[model samples]
Target: MQARKTIIRLFTTFLQFDSDKAIGWVTDGRLRRNIVNSQVYSSEIENSENFWVTYWYKQWQDNPKSLAKEHLLAYLQETCYWVASKTVKNIYSPQYTVSDCFQMMIARTDKVLKGFKPEMGFGLKNYGSAIFSSELKELLRQEQEIDICTNWRLLRKLTQKRLTESLENIGMNSKIIERYILAWKCYQMLYTPTQRTGTRKLQKPTLQTWEAIAELYNNQRLKQLPTNTPECSPEIIEKWMVASAKAVRAYFYPSHISLNVPHGNSEASRELIDDLPGDEEKSPISQIVIQEEKLAREVQQDRIKSVLLTALEELDEESRKIIQLYYGAELSQQQIAKKLEMKQYNISRRLSKSREVLLYKLAAYCKESLHISLNPPVLDYISTLMKEWLKLKFNPPTSEMEN
Candidate 1:
């Protein structure tokens, strides 16, 4: 448990993956390859351009069947303890603690990475053991600062150096060591947030692409509504037809418009809502695939409109129409009331109530779209910012992280 805690802390800082969103990104293989190597016991070995001149180089033409790359890697993992023992022998320190074991890997350690190249059975000279001095470390540090944080493996040695020093200060007190390790785990958990799946700043191509997607989705939605189930009554059909119309209407006036386009709402916004599949006719068990396909389509389309429309679908058609006319069509409350043959005050009351429903929907939408858990205020801020982000490209003024 103590080890786990410290490791968690190490992961938090190393990968910045505290949230589920962060976890999803990491697990999905969307993270930097360096993290796997430097952060965890990564299996991959990256050979640089002058890889032969630096470390991890190998001389071709030797006993080729000696050690396979896969075998060598497996051996490294399986024999780290033995390696630690060998280091201890070289260093001649008993009670040296785990820090010394890692230090062995860091410096004053030498080993022949035995590996054989297949096909020709050539003898390979593996240079697995080498130490970096402070000067070398400085060079490494400079390289990291110049590079993006994606190459986190380069940062691990540095992180470990400090952590090892910190660990050494605590002496060998078991309780103290346990406490510190626990703290480390908590630290890792805290640092991890949402990971960047794609580029952060919204660009013109992305917006235009989304706009095109919205149109395609609108057609698919129209096709899907009637195909979902057996025929139903006029009342049910009316409910769906009016709700769909309202959603279409509401889509016109987005709460926040994408900034990439000089004209925010000049281009048409597509409606992408489908009437709920006939739940009454549904089997006792649900078809997850069908639902997933629908959800995936929703995600692919103008995700923003999909989110708002989803909320609009939950309310009665009358309320939905009123809300749509009020916000979507930019209709005055009095005008909406007059068109619907209702009192102006009633229109106001319904719009307010529908707004609450839509707000909840927007919150859920943000969670799905950004993979960020946000409360009302945070959701509002994110929604607003995303709209602003949409208007600009990932260039000097808008881009925060320099690629």
Candidate 2:
């Protein structure tokens, strides 16, 4: 049997908090208590989730200092954890961790909330899941960049302010930091990696290279720092450089937070339970509920696809060609303009206008068929979804094309 969706329980369990602790995080205790007790986080009770989301969001907007803000954030964090867990799915490495991506999603909550409109008919979790997925992709890109960079390349890329802050974070005194920075400057000036290729795999400086760097540092320290500062040995310079690289790496990587503990508390965390709320057994009713949800999702997806297909068919030939060239052929605006004998800006304008028209149709479909309200946020979200769908629909795989 398929397992019941336990997103809420998973959230609370990862938080290492019980319903009481969760309630304590909120100012409006009564509402939170009602939610926890009723377990309205299930698919059947989705409207309950929507209500609390809009209610707490309003509280936050009305008063930035409102205690209900905590509740609002916690609710959104549930969506973040859900998306992050699904995206990462136990695939951890030195470069990426679930907690790290979760942190990135949490960081984007403000931007996500700012762009969310409850009037749009989509639930907050649904909205947040899309943005969180994008943020995770960006995090992955950054991690990949850092992962591939050698220590030398990483340090070379880091700004002086970042280096200073990193050294300071490790409790280095200002004077020592200054000496380290001066040594680094001398090394940068003197030590050049002999092997120059496209790869980031720069080998460590040889002993002779380190000695040259030390000689330069010794000669320049008197000019750069306090006149009486002692000259450093090659070993000390090498040690400082290695330590600086370590500091940069430590500062760049996301801090590992324990999922089993609540934020800001050091006490022992609560343990997970075997049974989720409201569904103890694989009963026929539970199975029916799950199937209904699955069916509803399929229905909604089909409706969206139908609306998009009709809208595309109704578009003008030129607009259709523009979309096909841009999304299907994956051509740049300039390239499309060149091939079509039009100005680049004209191609850009046509693409924008085409998107707007398609988005408007989708928004109308949402109102007429899906019973969703028309709002700027809703239109923006529909635009994102429409663009993604168009890209996927237009851009079939090479093998499929060949067939």
Q: What is the TM-score of each candidate against the true structure?
A: 0.21, 0.48
State the lDDT of candidate 1 residue by residue for 1-403, as single tens digits.
Answer: 0111222122212111121111211111111222233323312222211221111122112222322122222222212323343344443335433233433332222223322211111112112311112212343334334243221221122343344344444343544333333333322333232445332221222333334433443344345433442433324322332332233223221122211113325454321111111111111122243334334543533565566556667889999677556544547888898899999999989877876666666666656755656756565444433322222212112112111
Task: List runs of model 1 lying over 4 Å from the truth.
Answer: 1-301, 382-403
Candidate 2 TM-score, C-alpha based: 0.48
lDDT of 1: 0.34
Q: Evaluate model 1: give its TM-score.
A: 0.21
Model 2: per-residue Cα lDDT at residue 105: 74
The ten-residue window of minimal lDDT in model 1 covers: 19-28
| Highest-TM-score candidate | 2
Model 2 bad stretches (over 4 Å)? 1-70, 81-100, 103-131, 148-150, 157-179, 218-231, 261-403
